[model samples]
Target: MGLSLRTSRFRGAVYFGSKNLLPRNLETMKTRKFLGISLSLIIINLAAIMERADENLLPAVYKEVSEAFSAGPSDLGYLTFVRNFVQGLASPVAGILAINYDRPTVLAIGTLCWALSTAAVGASKYFLQVAFWRAVNGFGLAIVIPALQSFIADSYKDGVRGAGFGFLNLVGTVGGIGGGAIATVMAGNDFWGVPGWRCAFIMMATLSCLIGFLVFQFVVDPRRISTDHDTGKISNREKLIDKSNTSSVTVWSESLAAMKSVMKVQTFQFIVLQGLVGSIPWTAIVFFTFWFELIGFDHNGAATLVSLFAAGCALGSFLGGVIADRLSQIYPHSGRIMCAQFSSFMGIPFSLFLLRVIPQNVSSYYIFAVTLFIMGLTISWCATATNGPMFAEVVPANHRTMIYAFDRAFEVSFSSFAAPVVGILSEKIYGYDPKSVDPLLGSTREAFALSRGLLAMMVVPFGLCSLFYTPLYWTFKQDRENARTASIKETEML
Candidate 1:
């Protein structure tokens, strides 16, 4: 009787233990799934906000500054330069900050800075003050972009990194589209006695601040994801085994070191040069509102057209990412260079045709719009596709932010120098008289002609930039082969 009772108790104990373990197992799985989804959502949201902010601030501010200060194309171009110049100076510093500090905290600070700077722009009574705040806003953006990109690269696996980047680009594009339309509507009509442009800035600032709060509260530091295994309580042998096998810290460090080592790679140097050249044309488009007005569009029309441009960019980014990812399977490192080359080639012809051959008839508006849309699609998508994958391949996941920041710094610094030079060249070489009117055709037509001519010159640099990428492709191929050989050797040894 005693033995039977003991056996029954043992069976009961086993049943209860299994039941308790089931819930705990389920809970662990649930937590992991939740974390994955949460991180993805956060990344998407952050991308959207960043893109939205960019689109919102530039178009509206250009219009407001031009109208208020009676500024010409050169003055407007200088303003664009100021924004990018500050970004150039700030990005590397931001990258260093990202390396040493908690990413979420750094990002939150950036977001707040963006909000306050934008708000200050809206409130500014002087042109210099507006320009100052715009620079401040650019500084904030410089901090945010690299940090967020690094987070995404660290969070996602290599196999799906392309898709992950694509999604991020897509979200950003969507946000940009929304932002453009919002800016257009707000600036097109006065809201509650506030100037339409002021309202736009206010709205952006409020949204930025709100998003910053969300990020600060809910975004977990990726560093925390591996801390449990990094605890000092583990034996040295066990730690060594883990380091050789499943340790995230070791992987992270290796990835970072690989990126830092890129300075030694000649291919990376060429890529950075290419990036700088590409940035020149990109900056022109960002300040395109000023160009548009010079080309005969009013503020409202320019805003609408900019919105269309943003839409094209959104579509292009998504398509480019998908195409680049597919091509990468076969060509590996060379795929991005090919995409960039094709795009650059297409841009030269398209831009030259638009500037040189297109007639100034009323119907030209429709034709130009279509052309701009196609240009927007191809340029934005192709640039993004090339940049995203190339950067990912060249740098380690952890060091991506630092490399990207430095890349942006170089790109922006050169581009900023180009902007003012472009402006001055237009004024001097193209015979642009901001005060003069062509009695027969009108001042607007004369301005448009000058702007078109200046934009045409930009195509030269962009086309020439393709040459830089060719050598980079070969270098990347060699690096990839070396890595593959090493990886195979390790597998065999194991």
Candidate 2:
């Protein structure tokens, strides 16, 4: 007899047969897709958006902030560094919590932390206060991101995992674009005597709190309702609940075990190795708005250019994932690595073209716009297309959160240095003077100097990132098969 799972729209009531079993392929089974796209997927996507928006909020208003605090690029860069470094260190907490609790709870807690921090940053009177809150914001993101990634991993099987992550990132980038654009435009005006940038953070915080509540109340953890893919059995559903109810000692112990298990995976090592170098370029790109402003673009003009680039990245990430998904089916061992290398390699030419080849002048607006859009399109594929889905396949289902968390910990911690490096390079080496920069009129000489620093950060890292993906060609297949064998063994044990 076919197993029947009946439920309301959101709160799933999964009914198993007399054997208390489900088909091995949950993707083909009907018990999946309980809430459709409305609740689970959409809410997760919204959560992704909320996180990205919070991330982009501070950097988006860098000019306003610089003037307000009389801070320079290096100081602003330190704020970002503090946030990312703290977030990276705290990321493993997500995995620990996920082991003991449902992902929804973990997400809710994360949202609460970030929402408070974002609001606090807006209210702070001193730069140090803002820096502290930004660090708190990073901690909150550290928790939310891994849960979100692992949730998608469990929701989609190996075959279409790339597309699933891509869709997640695609939606997330919208928030990044929107957050950055809105903040940039708003910084030019004041709302009810409050700075527009401050208002933006307050509004985002309120919305994030609401989204977190909705997620906690409505969205069901896919793990709670579905069987593990390879085993056709519930891996840790009951155990998760029991552990949550048990003492805290058990939770930490499980967390440590998961971390150890995740660290041993060779595929994960290679991916993290590449990500350490790969992420620096992205970190450095946070200066794009500041550079554009210095290059004579007004608020709307800068927002427009950045949004086009972000839109390109959003679409490119989805397309790359789709292409990788197709290629992986044909060449399971090496397709993702090849796609990743191609995507990372594209960054070199594009970075050189945007920062050096094109003249940094108001006359080149259309040219800059087109080039940025395409550069984003080509270079934004690595994470969604390869790293995420690849990480999912190398580890067991329960270890997903830990692997993602650790990856963020390693990659983000290393990449966080890029912001400060870029800032120092521009000011110390390239002769960028924050005091001389005119946010309104723009400064051509300072802009040129900043571009030189940006070029330095972007090109070499892109080259190294592409080279780092090579080792994955050998390790992926072996690791994937081992994971499969481990899953089968897990099924037998259960």
Return the top candidate by TM-score. 2
Give one digit per residue, the lDDT tens place, for model 2 in 1-494. Answer: 22342234222434435124444445345444555434788898999998888888888898888898888888999999999999899999898888888899899999999999999998989999999999999999999999999999988989899999999999999999999999999989999999999999999999999999988987888777644344455656556668668777877777788898899999999899999999999999999998899999999999999889999999999999999999999999999889999999999999999999999999999999999999989998898899999999998888899999999999989999999888899999999898788768889999999899889999999999999999988999999998888877865776
Compute the lDDT for candidate 1: 0.67
TM-score of model 2 (CA atoms): 0.92
Per-model TM against the reference: 0.83, 0.92
Pairs in clash, predicted candidate 2: none
Question: Model 2 residue 162 lDDT?
Answer: 92
| lDDT digits (tens) for residues 355-404 of candidate 1 | 67776444467777787778767776544566655665655434567777
